[model samples]
Target: MTSERASPRRRDTWIVLAAALLARLAVVAWAASRFPPTADGTFYHRIAERVAAGLGYTWLWPDGVVTYAAHYPVGYPALLGGAYAIFGAHPGVAMTLNALLGALAAVAVHRLAARAAPPGAALAAGLLAALHPGLVAYTPALMSEGVTASLVACAAWAAAWVRDAVPLGARRTIAARTALLGVVVGLATLVRPQSLVFAPLFALLALAPLAGPRARRATLGFAALATACALAVCAPWTIRNCERMNRCALVSVNGGWNLLIGADPASTGAWSPIKVPDACREVWDEAGKDACFGRAATLYITEHPGAWLSLVPRKLAATFDYCGAAGWYLHESNGAACGDRCKLGLGVVETVYERGVLGLALLGLARASAESRARRIATRAVVGVGLVFLFLVHAWVAYAALVVAALFGGRTLLRGPVLPAAAVTVLGATLLTHAVFFGAGRYGLVTFPLLAGMAGLVLAGFRTRA
Candidate 1:
């Protein structure tokens, strides 16, 4: 019948999309049943309930007592609240939404990888992302990681589109894509303020190919648009905070404090167990006696600069150690923790066993020798993000682990058309950073998608070679 002929590309995309959706649904169901509620989940869940009950952006205790002391951003809770409005405050519904977003993220990754590599590579990347254990675990939780990851992936995809579409002599398409990129980045910032780090980088990267007089103007315009969108989304909470607390903070006020805690000798090291007053005072000069716990950490860092310098390696190690294991890194033992004691069980052991020693060794070597173009680009981005966190936040093992994972994971994913050099560098970075710092399992989740993508690429290459 000469009815309708679907293009091969369209058909392939639809098939991949359908498959991704099914896989995500399965992950959502598994996550819903397999994992118990986590600490952050409880916090976000309760916050969402409060939001649903018209508490607005104000944090409150279960007893209806107002508490602005909580350090979390409002994006995830607000999303959960919207879900609660429709689904009646059920955690499962909220999780289902996360699962959906995660699936969307897989789709985005697939498109990006496919454009950069090949269709098969894209499909493999999408499948890996959908089935990623780390992502699966967080998909149904009340936490923001899954949603944030999705947002990041979406932003990356948007950036890729802007980059590719502009060069193909599509000016109109470029403008629209750039606008969408701005919107996506803005949305990502709302979810996690840290995403601001990538906004400028992406803008600069996107403008690289644009010619002469138009490039600068386009870049500036896009940057301004992105900033405006971000401010629009975040300004309400900032205004509310200013009116209520006289603090004109656009984001949360916990960055300095987190940095102080992460860099403090007393806290980052052995003194982590002890609750010392004035922990944050040195870095934040305005800190008072009651705020001494926060100042004290800063004071230690300032007074013992040499000691702190020496401790950097250790801090890096600790950041990558078991301590970075997402919610499991918490010291307290609970059903929600991200450690072996938590509901998820020992994920580190599981990863190690699943990956195997030989595979791990090969990955390690690959990461060490990642000197190629793709590896450099991905590593630079990872390093830039890591540096931002290191300077602005606290240098933790988890952060180190995150950087390594990104670097290695990106290399691994790209290794099919390329060699294993990038992967090796990423692994080396992760191990060295972890060895010198600290780590936790959850902290490693950020790179899980990359790892899965890399594994798929490696497998595909082996099959091809064989």
Candidate 2:
């Protein structure tokens, strides 16, 4: 009798897994059909192909056209290049790898949610994550966002599990698990340096449940080990950048440009040359300007105090504005050529117009409620750590805010006494930072799985109450 029941349960589990896998594959196929090769896709894919074809990493193409001069990190191209070499240089193969990574990310989300909530809520979270439109849009592209996001999700899951292990008095096991989390985080940083922001936040979140001298010492020791491990993995790339360019830059030369673009007085999708005073522009344009862009932006802000002050609120609004549009707007010498047919149409525009008011209100209320719950010292510490890293690195305040709101909603759903408050606090910190900087739809993707899990918890509660 027991064996028969267990066999049926096992079969049901397999069926569910198969269904989830199929759902993700179907989304990947649909995305592959909809969007052709984007400009970024063309650049990354071509470079990967070149790398696979035995072209040295630093060689410039003819007529001053450069292919691999550090526009992005080497990890993603290297991964895609290896894929191309093994499976023939096909876009489909590269996209398939991304789809697989995204699907694995869903699994990781399921594991994390399951640890916190019931099995039903966990399944719902996984399904919602699989169906999220933003994830759907980006997973098949050759861009690093989908893969990087997946890595981060995995790292977060590993970190959370490590935390769970540590509290259960498993010191050696926790140390091993935490080290693994560090390795995952290191790889994530290699794919996109921005993920380094999560390192300190993870440390704080991990240490929250521990107390006493022994726990503190263990926490510190484990954190140091993890940091050393991450640094060891990252050291090679850092050394390569320094040797190749004679500049000791750890990551890409895009942070300043990103900050300038995010804070600039341009429309949603626009790009412009970095403009400082003549002397400052020259100084800031040098390879060493990666460290100077912040100073230059600060100087710009100081000089145009009123204009800079006004940009804060404007940037906040821009971050949340869902025009449902796509891509950067480029200008031709002759006239403004609105390239690409992905522009918002009547239906998309109307949807945005209708939903804007309600979405904003719900978002605000959710954020406020989360903040109120996060008033404790521990929660404050988490928010502080995340915010400091966010301000120093990127400036997508609106995206941050939306994540916080969604987290608040998630916490509200779970009814767990502790995590909801912390989740909401992190969300608030994300929003406040986003408001001061900029936002993007892709940046908000990280929080959706958590939010979806939270939403599932909420719906379950409603059903139970009804």
Candidate 3:
């Protein structure tokens, strides 16, 4: 780790990246042949097509219903729109771009590992991300996951530098690092608003590593500057939403509607579509419906707190099932609805991916923590084992108890080890957010880079004690 004895850094990095890209391209080719882009992507493609044609982001129906777009984020479509503009609405081109993004994401993961631990670990992390099965398969899809993953990885790498290195660097250096973090995170947020959550959370956690007399001021300064830049980056979208929609929409209107989706009376907290009540549709526009749905969700949760709590375990189950049944790893082919067998097969794939690949990342992170004495992962280990046991026994209460204990017991660890804390916080936030609203397998994809970096640390091992 001190210096790679066997190979040069750039050579290793490119090797990892090239291999990852090749694998992704191969997977993209196979998937493109076997599966078509699903509905989730169909809308993105339609909007991109509309935009490419100079029609603006608008949708029209036969019933004289004219709607302006406010449902999804603009960034991914904007990327697709650019591709369409150049190549003219080709799915192959889009998939190729997605694969390219996934490869770049692998590079980001490599840098993240190198920053957090030793340089030797970087290639391992990159390789883990490159070969990650779900990551490879998702590369061919029209979903935002590929773009969001790449951005999040780059942001995470920048954030690691800000949190782990900036406090010790020069004054201007700190500012530059913080601003860069902001720029990357802001871009990621445009792709998926969930990226915004990391700014505040990581800022708060950044306070952990600053230890000098000036640590407090430095922490506050870093947080304030980073957050300011992020908010500034999002200003254009916020202003556009407000001016156009006649409402102050900081991001897409999907949050409230998503909240409502999870708060349904019959909701199990998994991603299931329910028919909107006529009352919900009384308001014509998505903005109005989102507001109405938010209120309805709030009312439902208030009136049925017990029901909400009951769904927590199910949601948590789905969220952390790793590759089990929920979270962001759910693989649907061609956006077509799957029968029970395919759903079950996807669950098995996720389980395999989570246990095998994610477990590698977890192990790598633990090793990194151990090598750097970053922060202990004893509590994290317990939680991992608990989840595995839960998978076997299907005893939600047992795993819930373990998770709660880990949350309380792990604070000391979280306070010291920045990457582990970041990783755990990401997993916790993703799981809790989805459980509170609704979850799909892809929701868990956001944490992939962090895990890969940790896995890299493990591979780096004890600095080959001279």
Which candidate's lDDT is highest?
A: 3
Instruction: Name model 1 segments beyond 4 Å from true.
Output: 1-24, 27-36, 61-64, 67-70, 168-173, 211-225, 268-299, 318-350, 353-440, 454-466
Q: Which has the higher TM-score value, candidate number 1 or candidate number 2?
A: 2
- TM-score preference between candidates 1 and 3, better one: 3
Tell me the spans in candidate 3 whose CA falls farther than 4 Å from its real position: 1-7, 63-66, 118-120, 163-168, 204-207, 275-279, 322-350, 358-381, 384-419, 459-466
Candidate 3: C-alpha lDDT: 0.66
Model 1: per-residue lDDT, tens digit, 1-466?
1223224334545665676567657755655554545666777787788889887766655696675532567788888898898788876688688877877777766665555444565566557666665565455556776687677667666776767776586767876776677777667776767665545555545555555787778777766665565566677777776665445566555444444445555544322433445433353222232245445556666788786677656555444333224335222323442344543454554344324322332333234335466764565455455544433334342244344534454423333222122223234444443333333344444444444544555444432110
Number of clashing pairs per prediction, in order:
66, 11, 16
TM-score: which candidate is best?
Answer: 3
lDDT of 2: 0.54
User: Each candidate's TM vs. the true structure?
Assistant: 0.70, 0.73, 0.84
Which order, best to worst by TM-score? 3, 2, 1
Instruction: Provide C-alpha RMSD values for all models, in order.
Output: 7.8, 7.4, 4.4
Worst 10-residue stretch by lDDT in candidate 2?
329-338
Cα lDDT, all candidates: 0.54, 0.54, 0.66
